[model samples]
Target: MHWTIPLTEPSLGAEEVDAVVRVLQRGWLTTGPVTEEFETAFARKMRVKHAIAVSNCTAALHLAHLLCGVSAGDEVICPDLSFVASAAAGRYNGATIRLAGVVSQDDLTISPKAIESLLTHRTKAIVVMHYAGFPCRMEEILAIARRNGLRVIEDCAHAPFAWTRIGHQAEFAGAIGDVGCFSFFGNKNMTTGEGGMLTTNDDDMARRARLLRSHGMTVPSFDRHKGHASGYDVVEVGYNYRLDEIRSAIGLCQLAKIDQLNEGRRQVSAWYREALQGLEEIQVPFLDRPLEQSSCHLMPVLVHGSYPEIKQQLANSGVQVSQHYQPISSFTAFGSGAAHSPFGPWCLLSLPLSPQMSREQVRYVTDCLREVLAQKQLV
Candidate 1:
């Protein structure tokens, strides 16, 4: 079921291959110097004090929940429009989830007002996801957290270099919250095959996350193998969520080119915006926001009529499309019937997007969309 253009593609090249080969040649396959280097580079890029590389984004989110004191009986408030992992991480710690609606159809981020309304004495933390690499209304969200004495965990899976205005300063997505969790999956702005990074400014939380990422050992196996530590002790209960050297090396290569790659994405998004403009049948979210502030991980459009039919038509035309997410409440696992976002997920359409995309490709997609809509009107 391969379309002419896939939903997304990672920009991997000879540099990544060389990086992986170098790691294999070094023979220290587990998390070691390369992982440390990746973490340092990522932290420096995001302007964070500490970055703990993990097995995946879920591990980073779980660690963030633990570090923020989200435990059983406590509630974690997050957007209903986000991927399930946004809430699942809190559920991992036995915390209940409170779903908050989005701001509007034009800005599908979590509503700070909705978050404020859902607060309870049992609320422990607020999880905000920057949808499609666009910064959430972080200034307001952070103010809500500060007012409620709740920790803020940013789900930066969709936003790597994206930033928000905080007062006169521009703070990077992962650096604004109490703890930021990032994904480096194959489709993300950057790729490490499967890996994640947890960032924090708090020294104590950073130490705890690093310790807990690798089974709470007093000393990591890498250190012991290098004669830096004679022995080790397990001080706290933790999981085996360490990123290996191979992925770290690849991550380094990806990190090096992320700025340029994201710029390409921004350009592609702009092309889509221009191509789709004046098509009253479709609406693009976040149009009011400047493109430079977003990593533009996705090009989601709100289809006005018969979304399923249009999606199928696009498929027939050799175009690929996707949905950012379905309401978390729609899943049987989360059927406890929480308030859902009113952004009409059923009509949300994600057109193919990648830094590799060309203006011609975008125009083709838009043309297909217009033709499909015209055909539907006659039916």
Candidate 2:
């Protein structure tokens, strides 16, 4: 196909539209039954006991920090390779942010040992990300967190069902952590336009997350919506992080097809790996095995040398390729002079992998990539 293919696109179907229509017809468009249904289905799909839907991944992270009771000067260790929202969550709750180096170039997930080395009396939590659907070393990281009495907050933005195993047992990534956060943004494994979900087994933590997602409203939102009861009150100040019914309706529908969409992404990733197998300078991405069955959110790759030129060439060839991310430290908010790895963020590229894409299409894109890499002397 000659048309533009986005790096990540929603796997929306007719079911999503029908569900949203039902919700819109109901007239109560705020957080309601649809949101609750999305939460329940998301929790069940993740095989966890609780899931709280919110406005976005940022809200989920902020609520996790609040539930952990992280405050000013308290440190939370997070990977520098991920989106800024991961660390900003700590700052949102008035906590000190501590950055940790990535484990390897392969997956770029945070190393448990790196996190352990940074622990101190002020350390409050470990915000580990499942980079690009590749599950981190959860067992090692959780062991360190448990040993240090530090809370583990999972960032599932890139990983959906990515989890762990223990000698004939199964362990979902977010379930093992103290609190887990997930994004349903358009570019994620699955999307709700803009939404997030939080999961935890602890009842107290679940309650606190609920309060924080709302405006710290003391009354159940359902009751306030009914207006049959007395007026509501805000017991604690909170952000407006609730996921409205319209978005929740979309999310609930999306959750039902999560496995199908995930499988498509996985197949696309496998095809990319196989097609680019022998290219000397082109390295397609892979998740660290023995742990995660990644949802394959993106197919970011390294083209040995001519990375920038390859992107330009691919664009000229009518292919849409993009860098996975820019180093957060390179941004103005984090300051300009801080040193970043030469290949850390700028060196990677993402290929399209949606259910809407076909095997032939994936091959076409890869062929274009191979051509560009070769022309640029990268492969």
Candidate 3:
């Protein structure tokens, strides 16, 4: 079934097209000048000392855990309400993945108090996911980490440009933690087709991450190409998680227009709130959070007791909806048990949200949802 309104669509235009064309015409691909430029631009935007581009956000997370000294016998705390990558990255580094509960039904982000309760001697880091591009309660979370001597790695896949205030200063989402990981997958606020970036303020960690991102080489291929270095030596064991020049080109273009794209998403979210207001069956989360700004990557609603049926009904009406995630603990590999929180697997619905969507399309989706709920007598 073709969706009249899809869950998300990348905001691509002539700038992205031209950037890709330029990279292709240059003939040199792989991690080269374009990738370096993209990393530089991203680093500047986040106000971080370094931004290391990688294959995807998962790679960024894995590398961050390693840099943070998470290893065997160590435990990492992550929200149950996020993509599995948040927890799985710690597991990749031989750390035990401990689950942390969300704040509440109204705010699907990790609770700082829950994180504090879960911390033990073995806890090495806390991985915080900014669900739906809403900034997590970082000020409180940071205080917790400081008191416990644990590192913090932000899973900022949904929050490319989102910010929150700490006292009188504002900080970007990815830059707020010790290490921030981002995704540029097709459905994100910005797209590089498939790419990721890691941001950090520590000089030594940045150097280590740069080396680890490309086979732990002393010199990168691009540097060698420019004759800045004659040969390279492997200093440490690392993975081949480098982002190519083509995707880097796309990232640079997307970064330039990210604010505009995010604003469009915000407008659509506003339209959703106004149109869906007074519908008792649907609960919109994060309407009252006091963030300086959000990237608005998704628009999710909790449909009281009407999930798969409502989903199918919307599909039949030519609208596409998605579940943002099933709690990490619900997976068989992680032990198929319910998450500690009430907002567990399959209860939430992510509506169509994208920069390309218009107010008319949003209204149409709400109308379809209202009809579906009435048919089921859910409203």
Candidate 4:
């Protein structure tokens, strides 16, 4: 079925097309000068010392876990509501996953107190997802991590430029932790078709990430292309997770307009909040958090009951909706059980939101949703 209002659309314009064309014409398609430039620009925008481009956010997380020394038998605490990548990264390094719960019904982010409760002597790292681009309680989470001597890997795939205040200073989401992983998939706030970046301020960690991203090579393909090195050596076993020049060029273009795109999403979300008001059965997340600046990547509403029926009704009306995630603990591979989080997986509904969507579309979607819920009440 064709959706009258889809979940998201990438805000790609002439600039992105032209950038990709230029990269194609240059013929240096692999990780080359353009990729380097993209990494530099991303690092500057993120206010981090180094940014390493990779194939996707999952690869970035895998590299981060590897660099952070998440070995077999080590426990990594993660939120139950996040994408599986958050836990899978640790599992890739042979670590055991200890799932933590979200804050409460109103806030969907991972709770610092929940993380503290799950902490043990074997806990080596905490993978925190900034769910729906809302910044987590970072100061509290950071303090907890510090007290326990645990590394913090921020899964910032949903939050490109989201930030929070630590005292009087503002800190970007990806830059605040020991390592930050970002995604540029088609549905994200920005798009490179498929790509990701790993960021960190620690020099040693950054260097190791760069080395591990490519086959633990002493030299990168770009360096060889530039005649900086004639040969290379495999310093250690690594994975091929490099982002290509075409995607890099597209990423650069997207980075230039990210703020404008995010602001557009904010406007759409504001419209949603106002239009959704006084709906007794629906609850909006992150309405009370004033200090954190969200990237507004998604607009997820919690429905009290009959979620599946409501979702199908919306789909029948030619509106495409989505669920942000199923609880990681509920998966068959992970074993069927209740999620550790207070926010159950079945209640949340992701509405249509994108920078490319117009105000008329937003109004139409909300109008249809309101009509659907009202009709359901009548029955």
lDDT of 1: 0.91
TM-score of each: 0.97, 0.93, 0.96, 0.96
| Candidate 4 lDDT by residue in tens digits, 1-379 | 6889999988989999999999888888999889999999999988899999999999999999998889999999998888988989999989989888889877889999889889999999999999999988999999998998999999999999999998889999999989999999999998898999999999999999989989999999878888999999999899999999999999999999999999988888888888888888688888886523889999998875556787898999889998878789887656476543245443788999997787888889988988887886788
Question: Clash totals for all models, in order?
Answer: 0, 0, 0, 0
Better of 1 and 4 by TM-score: 1
Superposition error at 294 for model 4 (Å): 0.6
lDDT (Cα atoms) of all candidates against the true structure: 0.91, 0.79, 0.90, 0.89
lDDT of 4: 0.89
Q: Candidate 4, after superposition: displacement of residue 268 in Å? A: 0.4
Q: Write the number of the candidate with greater TM-score, choosing between 2 and 3.
A: 3
Q: 2 or 3: which has the higher lDDT?
A: 3
lDDT of 3 by residue, 1-379 (tens): 5789989988898998898999999998999989989999999988999999999999999999999999999999999888988999999888988888789888888999899899899999999999999989999999999998999999999999999998899899998999999999989999998999999999999999999999999999888888899999999999999999999999998999998898898889989999999988888999896433889998989986546787898999999998878789888777566544255432699999998788999999999988987887744
The most accurate candidate by TM-score is: 1
Runs in model 1 with CA error above 4 Å?
336-341, 344-346
Clashing pairs in 1: none
Q: Which structure is stronger by lDDT: 2 or 4? A: 4
Please report how far candidate 3 places residue 40 from its true position, in Å.
1.1
